[model samples]
Target: MTYVFNMHDAKTKLSKLVELAESGQRVQIARNGKVVVELNVVAKKSRPLFGEFKPLNIWTSEDFDEPVQEWIDAFAISQSELELQSNKK
Candidate 1:
């Protein structure tokens, strides 16, 4: 079914017009008895929610999460040098 409303009537009853359009009925707004604009219900798209987990097809070694040996050794050396300088002061 098609429902037509004049500009002033459409503005006052906007919500009712939207409801009618969403229910698969044609709705039109007119000016001086000539149709000017139409109202339609846009389909809602599905979206992924925040923090949704999706797995990637990638692999890593068991030690990938561990700190590198060279970095650990450098840090230890820096720490020992700092301690020696503090002891001398």
Candidate 2:
């Protein structure tokens, strides 16, 4: 639905008008009984699909799936701390 609002009412009810505009409603703001500005929902820009063509022989490194030793040690310590905290409750 299109909502028409005068300048005074538009200033007071701006938030609600903005919500209505954002939900695809056309909101009109007028001065001296004439429409001055229009608010409407902006359409989102579409993204183009990248790399649709077939790539030749892209291979990942052997250690790609392996966890770092530092992170493993930290994870173990975090688990131990969590267990201690759970036992105290």
lDDT of each: 0.95, 0.93
Instruction: Tell me the lDDT of model 1 at 27.
Output: 99
For model 1, residues 1-89, the per-residue Cα lDDT tens digits are: 89999999998999999999999999999999999999989999878887675967899999998999999999999999999999999
Q: List all candidate RMSDs to the true structure.
A: 5.7, 10.1
The global Cα lDDT (0 to 1) of model 2 is 0.93
Model 2: runs farther than 4 Å from truth?
46-89
Query: How do the residues 1-89 of candidate 2 rate in per-residue lDDT, one tens digit apiece?
Result: 88999999999999999999998889999999999999977789776578755778989999999999999999999999999999999
TM-score of each model, paired residue for residue: 0.54, 0.48
